[model samples]
Target chain A: MQPESLEAPTNRPIYSPVIVNNKSAHHLFICEGYPSREFQIFYSSVDDSKKTLLLVSESDSTIDHDSILVTHSELTAKLTQLLGEMPLSTTIYVLGSEAFIWDVHSVATQAGMVAEQIKMFAPVSGQRRLFCTHCYHITEDVTHSPAVCSGCQRNLLVRDHFSRLHAAYVGVQIDAEDPDDLPLPQELI
Target chain B: MSTDQIKVRVAAVAQVAPMIREFTLTAVTGSLYPFSPGSHVVVEMPGEQKIYRNAYSLLSDSHDASAYRIAVRLQDNSRGGSVFMHQQVKEGDELLISPPANLFIPQWNAQKHILLAAGVGITPFMSYLPEMQRRQADFELHYLFRSKQTGAYQLELAEQLGQRFFSYDSDQAQRCNISELLADRPLGTHIYICGPEGLIKDVQSVAEQLGWPDSVIHFEEFAAPKPGKPFTVELKSTGKTVQVGESESLLEALEEAEVAVPNLCRGGVCGQCATPVAEGEIEHRDNYLSVDEKARQDCVMPCVSRAHSDRLVLDI
Candidate 1:
């Protein structure tokens, strides 16, 4: 087994379909795809007394009166504007795929939001984004270990260690120790 | 003296305010060690009866290490240290000082820094100005003092900070509305406060009541340990007993007995001198320990805490 230090980041987003924070003066929920059941529960769970804004990336038939629709290209610009106008008492919750949520998180952070001011829901899909350590190249939509690096074309062992800056998991060559003693590919949870 | 002590000579002394004396200290030998902004040094004053060590914020430019400047405000209830500095200390006197230790630092990640100071509490923030300006950090300074005669660096700071500077003189009936100042701030705004205990407590309570998180409200209180009844401590490891005097601290008693305890910022703020307790009740005075930790009674900060019972059995 790998050492505890090499385990997944402790701050990795865990999906909790409830509004846990009640103290914030304002809340902003950024929903990425069509509103899933989890998103619906998360959005509706917000206290009616608190000020809230809902921004949905995709146009859907279930759009509510409180939700605003924005294209993927305009999402960053729209978030920047909203964050600029929001007060320090604001808390942001992002619900989307792993990559999409992290993208929005980056935008919020750039707009001067602290880590405590933002929350992330778990990615909707199990697909991972791998960063090749040897070539510093990113391979998207990875599912299993022993995945081929798109840049270096080497078999990689995807480690659970995550980087918030890169928004990806570290992947090192699997056969670096012994090229012939390659382990069988196993799917990641 | 401790191994970390640095010998320095007092180069010059100036009465900056009615009760404040500014001392400029230069290294006795080589160049002084570099320290970050918001750092304080403990000056050891050799009195006839005992050595008085007091922590003072470095008011000099953080980038300059050749000379260190500190201001001392004479307390009405004279702690021997401040009295010694104000009365006995003069130019060309050699004094041993501890290296700089910082407990109050600006949050670099903050988009805007709001510094709140009352009277001599502006010392640490004075060092922060150059560094903050160098980094181009957005910040503002709000100073509250009794009068122009007692407000050290009032004119200098006003001239330096210009539009970002604000002063509230109580003598002139000007007051700082803590709630109004903290209200409606943008996200990622962090506030730092240093002043009297009342001001610190007021700002903290007001910030919390205004829905500001504890992490965003930072403060540094250089509170000297209040004198209490004499007590005794027994070291569990050595079975040695040390008598703690009323005016002195438990940490000083332990040090006198040659039982060294790691310490910094001896004003009871730093947690370095936290000692495990074997037996006896503790009178917690330090701000370092939380309410739950104090209630646990398993540990004591020797720097300020005293024994509630006649004797304390320490796990030293």
Candidate 2:
């Protein structure tokens, strides 16, 4: 499918395995939880001398020697300040849940980072965030279809179509054609 | 005439610089089509012997569709097109021009834009100014020219753009530091260069050394096809031969022979007129093909490319 066409969400991030670009002058790694084995493997592929890590977690546990720890609320402010000073030769790696990674992606893009300059790892959780087309409401932590819109309390059919601007899956009224016809919520694979 | 052709009357003309002549063309019939910034139109100049079709960048405000303005610089080695505009064309004369087509638009999502232009190459950037200003885009213009006598619209640009405009006068030994200009730029900044081949190569090499991604750098080159040795091409299907003249392009030769081949821009930059080669050596001069594609030698862009062999057999 052509991503530029108005057909479907073919432009969704594939989250392919990271291959370190050796030419990049700087490497940045942002993790939501404790660094996973995948993150560690990817981080090791980068040059040891020019890497920086930012961990977003609530625990005050001991962290890596050079890593900075920040709470979820501080991720935006911290990322903005860090990205503002970063040069064009920097590559950013984000590892987190689906919602968490996209949230960081939005912030990084707003701070002048192109899609190519940023890399995202596969999401750790199957949960998603949905945006209702009818009420323009956002529903979080959705793991199944036929999710209810928080704002309008309407049953919506969650579609695979994703919007980078909204950073959410599209949701439309499932029973709009017939009021009596309503499909049961099924777990999304 | 093609449906895409627009009839225009020369509303005004001015010798902006020593070798540069600016012409303001108004619609002869109705309102002309609106065009984006950095768009160009191919003007058909009827010379004494033949029609010389030359592409010139639209330099007027894109929002104003009432008139299209273009600046033509007289080539030192006289090409009939620029010479006709310089010596024969005048106000109130009707001319045929192609509808505007753009290939050098600014990246709208860029955090900043840096434009590098030299001499007559600065024409396209003139239309970009009003649009950029309307959007409140952050941009800087770096212009390199010979001197005040030949720098078209240099003073007007400086006055309109103020500190954002930077000029380099070759006569005064002023040079633009490409390395310094590209260094330490923000992550999403885009750079556009429209200058001599040497200037474009210099900036590209410097930008590559600075680790800038290729996506962020853009350029537009419309090198006029130079006269070459005469050659011949044979159609593989019909076994008919067509002779290509020294002054005419292979695409033009094919058109004259009633062999239609799709084409646009007629400059090597656009890849529309690529034709398959069934046999014989090919001379690839287009910017659209990759190095590997050129090395393969299976195809050629007839608009600007020619034959290195005495005769070529085209798959057409």
Per-model TM-score of chain B = 0.96, 0.96
TM-score of model number 1: 0.90
What is the TM-score of chain A, computed separately for every candidate?
Answer: 0.78, 0.87
**On a 0 to 1 DockQ scale, where is model 2?**
0.50
Tell me, by TM-score, which candidate is best: 1
True contacts kept of each: 0.47, 0.51
Computed on alpha carbons, the lDDT of every model, listed in order, comes to 0.84, 0.85
After superposing candidate 2, which stretches have Cα over 4 Å from the reference? A1-12, A44-49, A58-62, A70-74, A98-103, A151-157, A172-189, B234-241, B274-280, B295-299, B310-316
Tens digit of per-residue lDDT, candidate 1, span B1-316: 4888999999999999888999999999998999999999989888887777788999988999999999998887765888999999999999999999889987887889999998889899989999999999999999988874468999998998899999999989999998899989988788999887888888888876766667788888856777899999999999999999998889877877888898888877879889999999999988889999999998999888999999999997
Compute the DockQ of candidate 1: 0.51
The 10-residue segment with the lowest total lDDT in model 1 chain B: B206-215
Clashing pairs in 2: none
